[model samples]
Target: MKKLTILFLAMVIFSCNNQPDKGASDNNSEIASQGKIPKTEKEVGSNTTINDYSQVETEKAVEPDTIKTNDNQDINYQPADNNNTNQFEDNFIGFASFYMQFDKPKQTFILKADEDKTITCKEGTKLTVNENSFITSSGDSVTGDIEIRVKEYYKISDILLANLSTTSNRDILETGGMIYIEAFSNGEECELKKGATIEIAFPAKDKKDDMQLFSGNWESDKVNWILKETIPVDSEENAGFTFVEKMPEFPGGQQKLMDYLSKNIKYPTRAKESGIQGTVYITFIVNEDGNTEDIRVVRGVDSSLNQAAISAIEQMPKWTPGKQGGEYVKVNMNLPIRFSLGGEDFSTNNIDYAKEFEKQVNDSNLSNTEMLEISHYIFSTSKLGWINCDRFFRDNSPKVDFLVNIGTSKQVDIKIVFNTINSILTGSTSGGKYIFDNVPTGHSVTLVALKYEKDQYYLAIKKTKITREEEQVLDFEPVTMARLKAEMEKLNRI
Candidate 1:
């Protein structure tokens, strides 16, 4: 505690003596780690008496002569020397117009607190987070390398009004957009005071915002959306998805959600017992086609429980209704799900949630000889516009070579990835391609096609050292996504 206070005092004095000349530039870019939207802050305004600060050690010492002068002179600068004016401000503020949308209002903020402060969060301070989504250090204090983030503060209305050009502007004129701050106490959680600042640096899109990657559509119900893709230009799927003209339509909608919740939304009894009552935040993107892809748990609890939540969201129905300019648009929504021990059975008599689990969840059929034969080749003029052979053997196959050539897609490479490498199929000399002549006759074995990932495909065919030789050509059929999922469940049953 004493050391932290001393450090804070030292940094404050450093600030007063050293004022680096910052360039006339603000380049704000955001990066991501563990989960969704990149952001963070340290624990502030915490009770000094309760949380342990005794073991907190002083900052590490840096070797001298490390900081070079413009002339590359050996000025012998030590990092701990607070008088060096060459360092940048450890605090920074970032402002972005509304989410991936156009026409959002924006704000510019000033971040305080140097990395050396050893400070805790108060109700209205900003924090620059690390990969763990928490502020571990104050961050780079060098002038040219300052990182920007606000702890827990809000924009002032007067500050908001300053960014506007006229009273007629719908954005600047909106008042409720203000933020609030509250501090936690004894047993009562802190609630934001009516006008306390809520460092809401990320503003909404106003009438005059930039549109480039922000265009999207909302379905009539507004529950479903098809947001614009934010993928980089150099991505493999460059063309991306086409823009949907109507409000995005969800195939399952509420019913799918109900079933998903009922079947998979199991309560984390242990965590609940521990009294962690925070809401589980789930987020994912809805593609233009109404499919829920990239499901992830933004805020997590127990690892196993987190997976359960993700599974529930992933099995949801395609959404409908998201529009832009009255056209359905794709989008990503942050969802909050609450859990309690009582939530064990999220079902009513009319609905059997597990029953709605349309398909099985495993694919052990990989050990079936028949499955391998049935899935060998694609039927010409097949029902599917394009077949993903890799998916047929998802993670299990007899032949190790993973080759997939569908119409004009990229040259699908094939490699065999296995849970166990020395098993019969993986070590084949012919790239997992089967040769009947190499085996003895009259042996019985099973074969199943398996696909782990790109460049890895296999046939789950058993090598029967059969004395009686029988040669049979096989064709493995590609199953629909739903069917593939059902196969997975079927394996789980066994």
Candidate 2:
């Protein structure tokens, strides 16, 4: 009986020693399921759990992904999932959202729907809407106050920041200007009533005779302009005399015209800083009423200098009317305004006198009598969205595709600015490459890349001449919002 009792005690002790601790087993199972390493009692502190200890170790083992640019700007980097295509598209959308803040604000006007109204914008665009002209999207008549929102884009800066391009059906266009108009009633979108039209008169200082009306079709994010109607021009104004008995003369003759240009043409600050100097050829018609009309830039160098030359020409006084067959007639005249910064004083009053004298001496070879084509773009439309005044861009150069490799999986917003034209092309991504197709070869262009991630703004800019099917690798650097704005402002001067 004593021996059996000892055996029983030994068996009990063996069972106790072989059995697992339920608490430790449960904790270890939980940690294994979470893909974390289980820690021993000695490794884990008194207050910390095994999962917590594993997490601390894992974090310490893996470093954060980051990139440092040449400017010493740090970018928090995240490797994009190659399996997810939507993530790339989402990144692009985010970039668009951030950069769209630079667009011009809409000018809103509240008007009674039952009353006729003539609204004039601060930029001199006139809108005339007849009474009861608004309808709901479902074709129901809208009464009460209608909200009219108008946004005008006259400057190249506005166009670039707005992500707008001058293109029609994949064909290039040279824009006179662009306007966006929308109407809302009761916080819902409204449309123009059928058979009721809104008249628009867009003021143009550099009006083109070939300018036509185009309606913008928004496909996704970009606008594709469709040729709509031909702007009508008066036959009388179009019948300017190329050869006349008495040529139209400036108010004080050629010398006075040269002096006026020298005194009034303010050299654009941006142009002076960039060392942009050239002659802008301005063409205008001196009408029978002794007034300058249909002013335009036949050839331009820089946008700022071109605008300055156009502005000076627009402010000229009435000239002596040309006479053809002993009757007052309209005549076309071309003026070449030279912009030079050879002297230390780069002020308007301190223009290069020698250059002006040389230009005057060469002016004798220019024809004073030429026929002018008139442009009167007054139009009535029942559609409201983006209305553009544009002409087809004529280029004889060979076209090629331009590709950009950012060497990153992150999506970016890309823009290609044509240095010589008022055109900006948005880039699209394919096979991890940003592509711009059919770009004119042998032209200077500025490539811009923008990104927004983790509340950080990044930018990259490159100016290059397109010679062939070229691929450029761009590296982006973090930039402050102010720096980004300043950089964008510089693109405006391109």
Candidate 3:
């Protein structure tokens, strides 16, 4: 019997690499390596020593060429020049905003350290973010953008209002509307804090930049925050998943994550001694800041194993974070960590490929030889089918391919999903065709198509059976906003 050798291959775990790769681990190592950390200074109004974490590294940010003064005075603005302007107690601020329509009003907060100095917006700060096009369910076009209303500013000791307002008057700020808010700590660090006068500037968005990319240096006696408001945007009437144009990614992608886990994960000595070896299911929340938190074992074999899994997860680097409708949002994720010693039982409990293949032949009402012939035809002729088969055979394993034709000329993103299967593979098409390979032979699958335009996503879905290699063309209407809202509600219920 040909077991699923791909899944059962022994993974070689290595010792953790102590030397941090650039953009690999999240710490002050980058700043330290660049020699940007400032000299130690005594904390004002406190007895502690201010450390590197509080200093601003102005190594990557370019200061604005001109500073518009409130009194019509032309003030020269330059980045930290390491002169008198770079005062020991000075601070720098940076700002960037994106156009987004919030389904619900979103509340955001700007966190500040206790040692932060008072914020002073010398020249009345105001920024106009150009509106972007987004469509409503009623086939209405809308523009989304934010303007700084310096007039309505609110100030407190450690917090300040964002003073943001929408450009369009439409109440499209209901559930499912999109909006953009740049996370403060989401870019390159520069040590550019100069004199008593605090300077703030906004960087132009680059083509390859994410919606929330803001790279500048914020400096002070301690790192201070400018905006602070607890604005909350409800994506739906019920807790709903706002599908993102791009999903969160590990720093070096999934392969690096696997490598990191292999290197960092430790088999609990106590669990090994007790012969406890099973997969540990862990779930965590990846915050908008790309940091993982709330990590806990959902399904655990033993306490020692559970703690070991949690420790390994806690040591992981920050992710790139997820974005929905162009705005960064917190996403929940689940991962399974396997902990097995040698000589473990390899039973159908793991995965039964032959049984599934036989069931596929039975369900298709075809003989084993006939099904094999059909699979061969698909692998040899169908372009997508060939690609799917090639991927399956690359691992020296065979799996059923589920191809679905959306029957549309418009370019839409498709996600072929198997409801009950393991080792699922991903494939894409240039047009409306989608191929999902590596599914269990005798199962069912679902295909979800989403057309993202401007800041809105129009969706369509179809479900079908999976038996051997075959293509299923589907007739699906564009998902209405009402239906999408209902689906979001159902997801919340689950």
Candidate 4:
């Protein structure tokens, strides 16, 4: 009996000795919750450091509300609350969720923090990050693995779905493209280190030489871009002269130049169908070797016409080189091409191309992608977040305020989309009304309003031309999620 008792005691002692320490188990549980584990004194030969979470105040997680459409499908819905002090804030959040539903999934890439890496997005956007280029919000250097999330907006449809607009300080902007980029290290948001710039080659179908870099500034619920600097125009190495002793001439003189343009210019089918007719002024540099280089649109009316004019000029044969003191020199030249359904041709006799070019250059209305016709927009940016390749829209039309009466004080999201320009504006509530101030008169626009109430979705869409300070009442109708999506898709076509 004594031998058996001694054996049992020995077994109990061995089991207890092999078990993990209670303090170590608790430490592991804490580390697991915090997502990182610090080395213990025994492991690092120093005291263990652990963050305290007891004093931290965390927001209560709100459960997503659901609504059943006519199709009997449950969809996540968040209604606006009028009782909230910041109605715009709530409306903006709801609008963001609504638009994000139609957006494509963001592209994600991983990189080592200690290595230089280049990530190419599926849409051909290239991002080059240098070694040790990232830091935390607290300004600490980031290490280990870094995660990059990229969202590219190239088409008008993409921009609409993302709820982005091409506007700066209430002025209009023509966009080449836009991109949203963010980085993360150890599941925490990271930023670029000081003096660190990520080289970006944002692919654009219509590259404009004057397309400038704009960084988005988020205020309230909308994003407004702020101009940074101009994108450099790619050109040959030469100190070109605006004036020369003898100007560059087209091969075989002015009449032949007109004939070349008439034969080569093919009016764009879309432009013809839409009845878009206007003149597109093209500027180019004739080098010492008599080759036309750096062709750009200094003034344009429509994208189709601008592209057509640029294409014809790009195919022109070498010109007779200009002269300065009887020696060949580079000279700047501008040509105006007319697109008319009436088949009107260019008459060189009535036009002085050089003087007209000089006057247009002095005009505040400058070159922009409003009519750009290139394959790619290349620029470098040090700032992250949302970056836009854009130019200010020059509109001299009269401006007026537009108002919408929703008839109910309930939460609503409103957007005013310009039909012709790449611009969108959010409506602000004032005196029980949603107002869009300083909108240009005599322009076509679409008004969209969205509402959610009692597990039902309500929507209103109206298209009209703003002739003056206009007021329209919106009648809300219950719509299924599918119908709402279809209606939003139509806005992208405009």
Models sorted by lDDT, best on top:
2, 4, 3, 1
Candidate closer to the true structure by lDDT (higher is better), 1 or 2: 2
Best by lDDT: 2
Best-to-worst ranking by TM-score: 4, 2, 3, 1
lDDT of 2 by residue, 64-179 (tens): 23323323344344444365555433333334333344545566676889988877676766677778998997888998887776778877767766667777766888776778
Clash totals for all models, in order?
102, 0, 30, 0
lDDT of 1 by residue, 393-443 (tens): 122213222222222212111111121111112111143343222222222
Candidate 2 TM-score, true structure as reference: 0.52
- Per-residue CA lDDT of candidate 4, range 1-494, in tens? 11000000000000000000122223334433533331111111112211210011112222234432224344554443445545333222244444544555556676888888766677767676778999987889998777676668876657765667777887777877777777777667788887666666666554444456787765443567888753222233754554444667788765577567766788787877776776676777788889888889877879888988888878889889977578997776666666655432223332333333333331222221022211344455555677887777667888787888876556677788778866677768877688877777888888877865554467888888876755788887876555676777777788
**Worst-scoring 10-residue span by lDDT in model 4:** 6-15
Report lDDT (Cα) of residue 167, candidate 2. Answer: 78
Where's the lowest-lDDT run of ten residues in candidate 1? 6-15
Which 10-residue span in candidate 2 carries the lowest summed lDDT?
Answer: 6-15
lDDT of each: 0.26, 0.61, 0.34, 0.60
Question: Could you tell me every candidate's TM-score relative to the true structure?
Answer: 0.26, 0.52, 0.26, 0.53
> Model 3, which residues run further than 4 Å from truth?
1-243, 343-494
Number of the top TM-score candidate: 4
